[model samples]
Target chain A: MLVIRRDLVDAMVAHARRDHPDEACGQIAGPEGSDRPERIIEMENAERSPTFYRFDAAEQLKVYREMQANDEEAVVIYHSHTATEAYPSRTDIKFANEPQAHYVLVSTRDPIEHELRSYRIVDGVVTEEPVKIIES
Target chain B: MAVTVSIPTILRTHTGGEKSVSATGTTLAEIIDDLENNHGGLKARLVKEGALHRFVNVYVNDEDVRFAGGLTAPVKDGDNVTILPAVAGG
Candidate 1:
């Protein structure tokens, strides 16, 4: 299960809503070996395509460096789907390099509502996990 | 000194079912060469036409190397190198 702050979930939902037709992507980092997600880092989708999302290569490099400097690791990697349900695509499973990270998907198919879910994509396998929202 | 390269599940056949393998090099290019020498067929899968395959994403210590220097990105001992395919689908 992935435990996240309610505010962070709201921020992600807002970001997904703001990027309506286009998909949004971002991540949360936490201290290494600690599954607690504490940092919300919004990322620019290089593709900007409604059906696809790729982190800007340069920006991704910088964020990784920052996480390393802070002795942290990406605990949750998230992206939004404008037209699909909150689930990992075959592609998402293939690109899931961080086996320890929770892959979160938010669907903004509805203008005013969103569907959020989390999963573990490890070794090309996908396992849905429960999300427990907490108060910060 | 060796750098640990994490192999995606689909490509583990090239590494003989190993999830990760240690190779020696000062740069990513050299590391690929080393991996190719040790694990045949991996280089062809990772690179095409003298460049990293467009569908592939390589990260050193979780940092994608394309922005750092691509194939020439410097690497050192004890670094973690990750190679994954670009995600697709909605």
Candidate 2:
């Protein structure tokens, strides 16, 4: 199961909500090999297309550098779906580079509630995992 | 100079299923050329029309190559280069 904090989940949901209609994307970094996501780094969707999202190349570079300097790894790479289920698409599976990181998908299709799910996309295979939201 | 290049699984068929391979080059483009020499049919999937394919993102030591200098980004011993596709779907 993928363990994460409630606040972080909320932050991701909020970011997805704020950028509703267009896909939202971001990263959550943690200490190397920790399998924990502690810091949320929001990234701009360069495409800004409701059906697609490519991180701004420059900002993506900066985020990776910052993580390197801090000795952290991108534990969770996340994006939202504005009109679809909280599941990865073929494009997402094709772009899954971080085999060890959790790929989170949030669906804000419902105005009242959002659907959040996590997956492990390794070797072009997508496997959904249980998420444990910490109360503390 | 020797550097490590991490290959995404989707494109591993060209590398004989090797996840990471070492090539010699002082620059990103050179390294890719070296890789193409060692692992034939790999460069075409990554480059198009004299530049990196639109969906490809190459990073040298965690820094995106597009901003560092595109394919001209420098590389040295022990550096890790990663190649990933620009992801999107909803």
Candidate 3:
């Protein structure tokens, strides 16, 4: 299960909505060994395509170094599927190298309603998990 | 030409759970070769058909090697070689 804050969930949804028609990707960082996501680090979608998303290499390095200096790790890696369901695609599973992260998928296919789901993708296997939002 | 190579968590199995390891080489290719000497299965993960795998991002002191020259990028003593699996999807 992934326990996240309400504001964080809202922020992710907003980002997804802002980048509709193109994929949006980012990560949430928390103290090392802490699954609690306390900070959101939005990343540029280098590909900038609706079907693909990649973190810009230089920007990724910068954020990674910052996390290291602050003793934090990415607790959640998230992206939006503008026209698809909130589930990991074959491409998402293929490129998921972070075994310890919660892969959050937000689907904004419907303008009035959004679907959000979380999964654990490890070794080419994806298992959906429950998400509990804590009001803040 | 000693350099520090930082390993991402996913590849730690190749380095016996080591987060960072030292290898000696004047170029990125040579460094990978030296690393393979001690960590047997790593080269296969980072290199494919004699080039850096598209799935991995390698940097020498903050400069991404893809722009520098791929596997032939130069490295010097005390440089940091960081390998990160590209966070990407299609």
Candidate 4:
């Protein structure tokens, strides 16, 4: 099971909506504790593409350092699907390198209509996991 | 019993454009071997010298096989195997 904050989901939806027609990507940071995951970071992907998203490694390193400084961790990595459902595409599965982190997908094909799903991907396998949105 | 394996677009050519196919095996390696026998170069596309290709991800029934048990992951009859490539755009 994955625990995400309601405010974090809202922020992700808004970002996806704002980048409609193109994919939007980001990283979700939270405490490592399982009972209460406090989302503490929001990152914007800089890669430009309608079909793909490439996270900025430098920015990611910065965030990682920041999280380390704060004693928090990067729990989930997220991206938006501009024209598809929250289910992962072939490419999404292929590129998943972090087996321990939750992969969240936001469907913004219909910006006004939002569909969010969380997954655990490793070695090309995608497993849908139950997600809990904590209200903050 | 056999398991159903789904091929992604990048590797469809190896499977002769077939999106999904069937193989018989109790473990992932056996099924992969069966696939290689049926489709030429399929094993190369997915595995290199016994290791999974860096760009290919294999999921069984929506669960990543790497985390489950890698090539030794158990496969039950009717299980679905999905192959996906790393998407790097956006």
Residue pairs that clash (backbone atoms under 3 angstroms), model 3: none
- State the DockQ of every prediction: 0.33, 0.39, 0.89, 0.12
lDDT of 2 by residue, A1-136 (tens): 8999999999999999999999999999999889999999999999998889988876776776688689898899999999999999988887777787899999999998999999998888999999999975
Model 2: share of true interface contacts reproduced: 0.51
Candidate 4 positional error at A83, Å: 0.7
True contacts kept of each: 0.42, 0.51, 0.84, 0.29
Interface RMSD of each: 4.7, 3.7, 0.6, 10.6
- Model 4 agreement with the true structure over A6-120: per-residue lDDT tens digits: 8888888888888777788877766654434566354555566767886654455455447667766557778888888899888788677667678889898874778999998
Q: What is the DockQ of candidate 1?
A: 0.33
What TM-scores does chain A show, candidate by candidate in order?
A: 0.97, 0.98, 0.99, 0.88
C-alpha DockQ for predicted model 2: 0.39
TM-score of each: 0.75, 0.77, 0.99, 0.58
lDDT at B89, model 3: 84
The candidate with the higher TM-score, 1 or 4, is 1
What DockQ would you assign to candidate 4? 0.12
Best model per DockQ: 3
